[model samples]
Target chain A: MAVNESLRVLRTIHYDEHHYSLFVSAGTIGPKTKPGHFAMIQAGEGFRPYLRRAFSIADVTKVAGVPALEFVVKIVGVGTAALARFAEGTPLPVLGPLGVPFPIDDLLPSDRVALVAGGIGLAPLVLLARTLAARGIAADLFYGGRNENDVLKRADFERFLGPHRCRYATDDGSLGRRGRVTELFTNALAGGVRYRRVYACGPVAMFRALAELLAEAKLEGSFAMESEMACGFGVCLGCVVPMVDGRFATICKEGPCVSPAQIDWARL
Target chain B: MTVDLSTAFGRLRLKNPIGTASGTFGYGLEFAHYLDLAALGAISVKGLSFRPCHGNPPPRICETDAGMLNAIGLQNVGVDAFLAEKLPELARLGATVIANVWGDTEDDYVAVVERIGSDRRVAAIEVNVSCPNVVKGGMIFGNNPEALAALVKRIRAATGHPLVVKLSPNVTDIVACAHAAVDAGADALSLINTLVGLAIDLERREPKIGFTTGGLSGPAIRPVALRMVWEVRKAIPKIPIFGMGGIETVEHVVEFLIAGANAVQIGTANFRDPSLASRLVGELAAWCEDHGVARVSDLVDTLRTRPRPDHEFA
Candidate 1:
């Protein structure tokens, strides 16, 4: 069940030159918020960029005793660029908290799980990391970015899972290790870091690569996928992902988070 | 005082002049959490075919200026699965279900309607002849007047349910298509299904959508839809018209009705606001009251066109 909320922008926090965090006043969105669920945000007031853009629920916190929702947005196109320019107290019409959330209940405290994210993909994984921490589960975080600016929320991840438990990699060698995030993941696997389950959110290519890696390692994991969505419900059928079972699943309803076995990598 | 929002399309009567457009409203059960299902005038489900369709590959959708393009390829669980899994839920909800049927061939269309022919829950059968994604019998049947008429007549004989022919705007003369459907025994008409369009990813140096082309929908196509509906109404005076294209607000609904549509369907707007159709119902009633109109149906085809001036002849 989703509800439309006219929330006001409480504040904006710039993580870097291009990345920012929008903290909005969450009316009823607080109690309904879940990890991997997103809001269909109207970029601006008119129909120029007609369709609403989907953003993951990055963080939920209280501002001056009032519940607020935070979204980590990267300015890539007209829709995101419009959202990036909003000032404090700007009214934002949002329809959410939508899509199937990550399966956090399936993991036990003793389970050694790894939370992997690429670039802006860290948005949803951060919330999942916080939830895992609250459950007394100490999961490791492996984040990869193009550079230091791309890995926008390193402090937030370190705060959730201490500095030692968090790892980083960058393609440009401006951050921790000079390589792709998957290389860090492969290194961890090679060092006898036996992860019981892996949870990831990133680009489709990354998911495809991770799917093959997980298959070779005989490990199980889930992925939070992104698609060009119209309605964040089952009706539009606009955000469909092919399944391994020769069927198509709507990313909005059946997933935003799907197990590796559900996706047909060959088709993707 | 309660306003009479009830509307009729041949023998099929709706409680209001508002309904969800096909492919936008899924079986009327998905939005159950947002609004009351039975309160809607009608619920048009996703397009169904003789066999289950996997749809097109990924990158099937992309956003354009003031609209979106999608080549979903009419994905659905065949007619049997629809009747078995979805019809019961619609029946229990007491909704006027308008099953949108499509196919790759004429026989496929007839077969789907025949399978759903006797279902008491199905209020109407909407023939989708305008899909632009598939490589088969979609737009081919819709673009030609003779082919459209022949297909509609075949399906008309196969079902007892009221037939609503959904037309395409991609054609040069949409009015001819509308007339052809009515002449072939169509009970009503709905238009315009998305206009064929293409979008490109300049960075990738390739087409944005996987199918290379898809149907363009949303507010961008609304004006074209309104004109086509107006033209069809002038061409055929008696048939009911269900107008849809980029309709987002109550004002857009009024514009459609004034343009000669008996009813209007909310398409892409459903994605932005799941409760929009139900909300528009209330807003429409309020608007009718504010404008001193007793019934919403009275507003249809009331556009006052000015007569040609005599100075041109002189």
Candidate 2:
């Protein structure tokens, strides 16, 4: 079930010039918020910009004794730009605890999982990482970005999962391994690294490549897909993704997190 | 003074004058978790056809200035699924259900309406002749007076349910289309469906929407929608009108009524706030009471203007 709340911004943590996180009072929806669940956050007042922006729940924690929902956002368009400019205490209307989350229940303490995040894709993965830590599972965080500047929340992951368990790959070789993050993933798989399951959140191209890699590697994986939507719930049907069965799955309803087998990468 | 918010479109009566627009309200079940389903005046469920529609490809919607463009292609569960799966729950919820029916042909439209005949649950049949996103049967039937008349007549013959023909704003002459539906037995009319518009991505040199062109809706089109509702109302004063287009507030609802709508539907704004239509029902009542307007119906066609200049409307 989803609840609509007018959560005021408690603090805005800037990861960089473009990347930031808004920790807002989560009302009743925070306590139940899961890893891959997302919310439609309204950044503007009245009719300006007209639609709420959908963001993944990075983490649900407390700030100064108030329960809060953390949203990691990158300035991409108008809605995000407005969110970037929002002052502290500015009330942001949010609707969520929506969408299917990454299935962490299937993994045991002995099962090692790989968490891959690209750019602001780290938003959902952070909560997932924290949950994995709590469960005593050994998970590796494959954080990738265009450069060191684009990489976000590295210290947060390092503090929980340890620096040795975290891997970094940058497109420009500014941080760690050079070339695309998918390339690093491909190299890792080729080098005979094994995992119980892989969870990923990134651009569509990354998922398309990962789907093929996972298919070839015969591994189970979940990809958190993002789409442009009006309503974060199932009604709008605006954020539908083509499935292998020739039917479209509403991302807002069926998943923001989906099994690699469920998507039609060719169509996407 | 108590404010009377109840309104009617001939045989069809709504507890209030604020209903959810077709395509925006999906079977009235989606928003059940967000708000009480029965709280709205009516739920005009997504446009249904003889068969389930897949709609357009991804990237079907794009945000614009105070509005958005969508080419959803009217993705729906078909009429049988709605009747079997969706409608019963809506009826059970005590919400007024107006079936918004569309098809690829005139026969397709008749099949859906006839299947829904006197369900006892459905309050009215809103014929979606104005969906600009579809290639056939939608605006094709709405753009021409004779075609719309013929289609409405066929629909009229098929079912005893009150017919509300949703008109397209893309037409050259809306009054002719309004008259065609009314003369051919349409009980009421839903004015100003989304206007067809295109948005381009300069980087890709391609259209922002997957279908090249999509219907534009939201506050940006309110002025155009208001003008159309007023024009149709002035031309066809006697027929009932369910006006809609970019309506998000009580003030906009009042504007529609004064411009001659018996009721108003909240469209794209429902995407922004799923509970909006239900909220507007209460807000409208409070607004009416505060303004000393006892009856919501009293606001209909109440616009007063100085004598029109000879060339103004022409």
Candidate 3:
């Protein structure tokens, strides 16, 4: 079930000029939110920036013993910029706990899992990492960004996975590695660092490359796909991704998280 | 005083005048958790094709100033699957279901109407002659009065169910198309479908939507829709007009009614609030009471416009 409620903005944590994390005192949303599930966040006060933008729940934390929802917002467009400018305590009407969540139930105690993210894609993966940590299942994170400022929440990932588990790559070489994260992933795989399962969310180009790499390595993984969504529920049929079976699935409902095998990577 | 919200679109009497627009509202059941389906005037399911469609590729939708654009090429589970799966559930819900039918050809349209028209669960068949997304038969028929008339006439002969011809706003004179539909034996008329629009992704240096152009819908298109509805109502006073385009609030609903729409459909607003139509039913009743109106139908074609003085103008 989804609820449209006026969630109060608790605070905004600015990671950099263009990136920030919004924490809201949403008691109703926190319990229902799961990793890979997203909220349709109303950008501003009225219908000017008309549609509610979809944002992955970056993290769910408790403040003053009350559960709160956090979203990592990047100012890429007018909607995000509007949301970024909102003052604390502003009433934000959110509709969510929507879309299919990442399946983590089948993970074994000893199985190794890899969590990969690109830029703002880290929003959903961070929550997944937190859940995995709580389950005593440690997953290494391979994070990439445009530059040093773009690669967000390094210490948070390290704190959750311990030192050396959180790796990074920046396109401009302003971060740890001087190449794409896919290169790092390739090297890791070549060096025989085997992961039982892999989870990724990123740019379409990056996902395409990863899909190929996963196929070549004969590895099992799921990808959290993003599309322009009108309704974050199944109704709209606006946010669709072509599946391998030639049927278009609504990413907002059927996914945000989908198996790589289910997607027609070549067509994408 | 009890405010009667019940309304009629041709022979079909709805419990209220509020319904969800086709393509915006999925096959009724998707919103079951958020709303009481039985409360809606009707549930106009997503546009259906003769066969299941894969629709367009990624980035099928993009937000505009007060609206959004979509090129979801009428993706559906085909007529057979809808009958096998969706209709049974809709029947159980005891909700009035309006199947919005579309096709690639005239035969395709007739086949779809024939398949669902006999089902008692489906209260009416809304022929989609105005979808701007599809390549053939959609807006092509909608743009031409002769084509629209001929298509409606054929479908009218095929289905015994009340036929609501959905018109495209992209035409030069929507009244002509409205008259064409009425003359061809349409039970009612629904307008306007989304206006053709395009949005560019500057960074990618390409269209934001997978299809270069898509149909624009929302609050942005409301004024245009109201004008069209008013014009069509004036041209064909007796026919029922199901007006819809960017209706978000009860005020908009009243505005559409005053502009001569017997019934109004909520489209994009459903994305923001799934239970909006259900809420609007009570709001409309409250509005009728506040305005000293006994029946909601009394508000239809109530727009009071100043008459032009004959001596000055001529």
Candidate 4:
């Protein structure tokens, strides 16, 4: 069996106070990875620290056509903090473009695709927004950040969806919508807004709220959610969802992104 | 070029060095999309017991610094149900299948292991000694040297299959447990099952996960796991050891090998990517071939503890 080489970490740079990103050239993954997929990254040059951390594939922009992958990471704890300090030009041992990718191509022309993101959760949405732009899908994005700077990867969100459609909600109302982004989203839905497929990635609470809102609006949607993953692959039952259809399923193999209805939303 | 990941556990030789953890991999079928059941060194299915368990309720996990924690109380489909449901399918998967058995009492443990060992489908048995010994009035067997040793001996006499004792890191001295198990006729040891941990919720003034306390695993636990593996490896150099905690990649396998683990099991890594093993299997070969290394095993213990140019170790 031909095993792919562990991905080499191309560079590590800080994006904000509690956020950073790693660019890796892993042969095992896609040159243009789809949104909703993630990778299990092992940092620290040695195995003294044994576990691999899972991160969302925030942006899939190919670097010079070689198809390097980058993660939009939040330094929630120690592993990530160590990850941020990794020197540039070092190779990261990347494991995958695991889990289900967002259905970017599934968006309809007439469908108004609304991408909802919370805090650093905007990473994947930014890439999805760009794909939506390239597909010329009429869409908009609603983002909620604690403050203005916590908002992530806006360049693509603006460039792809047009600046007018992006709305923001900060606790202090530092930017656009003066409250929760979901509040703005709820307003949009209350105002007779229509979208073909609503794509969302954010806090579990945010994802739940959106699912509830989407249901209230009688709309179809998918969610890119996070689970505490040990393996970015499917074996570990650690990251799982109690499906509505019965039986527990792995998030990595079955999906990081699943139909909103398929999720045991009540469980979340 | 594929490296032989198999190593002997007394009479049984695992096909590869990679296996699954008791709690993390569940019953092992969830990965049908990404796993080739036969390719692994062995499959350590989820922890099973005499009765079905609901597991601790949700909020059962949360993200920590580099790792995560879970208190999934050996929730399983009861041993009889597992045999009836999962075994036939696993039989077809064709690799050595090791059942990780857990129970509240010595009789319970003996019974479960005996039942599993009788089946031709099961190649071996792993005793989950890390849990509290319900019969000994609740002190965990893994934390005490004599308790662990005696348990291993009891289980060994109960089953003919290769006996493996999974160790817990919650104790102050893991080496003692490792040593005791070997002395009691254990064929191998798989270890560093999550460190004891707790996560608090500021809002409700409550704790995260269904249980107030859970096992911590993931990237964060790697350092501790490596240290424990190194400690036990240094103390008992001859005994076969299967290392785990947060193993997620080919490099992790290499790390475990270097730290004295004969093989490594990908625990938390299985949660996010299903094809990680297949990919890592491929990656390890390429890494070996690229380095002009004749065998992947050559990388074991070869890494020097050179200080990284930057970053704080403590």
Task: Please tell me how candidate 4 rates in CAPRI terms.
Answer: incorrect
Considering the two chains of model 1, state its CAPRI-style docking category.
medium
The TM-score values for the models, in the order shown, are 0.97, 0.98, 0.97, 0.70
Candidate 4 TM-score, C-alpha based: 0.70
Clashing pairs in 2: none
Alpha carbon deviation, residue A172, candidate 2 (Å)? 1.0
Of candidates 4 and 1, the better by TM-score: 1
Query: Model 3, DockQ value?
Result: 0.80
Model 2: residues >4 Å from true position, as ranges?
A: B310-314
Q: What is the TM-score (0 to 1) of candidate 1? A: 0.97
Docking class of 3: high
Tens digits of per-residue lDDT, candidate 1, B21-64, equal 99888777888888887888888899999998888887888888
Q: Note the B-chain TM-score for every model.
A: 0.97, 0.97, 0.97, 0.90
lDDT for model 1 comes to: 0.89
Model 1: DockQ against the native?
Answer: 0.76
Share of the reference A-B contacts seen in candidate 2: 0.81
Model 1 misplaced regions, further than 4 Å:
B308-314
Instruction: List model 4 lDDT by residue over A99-205, tens digit each.
Output: 78888765567667788899988877766777778777887789998888778777768888988998889988788767788998988887887788888888888
Q: Candidate 4 chain A, which ten residues in sequence have the lowest lDDT sum?
A: A1-10
Candidate achieving higher DockQ, 1 or 2 = 2
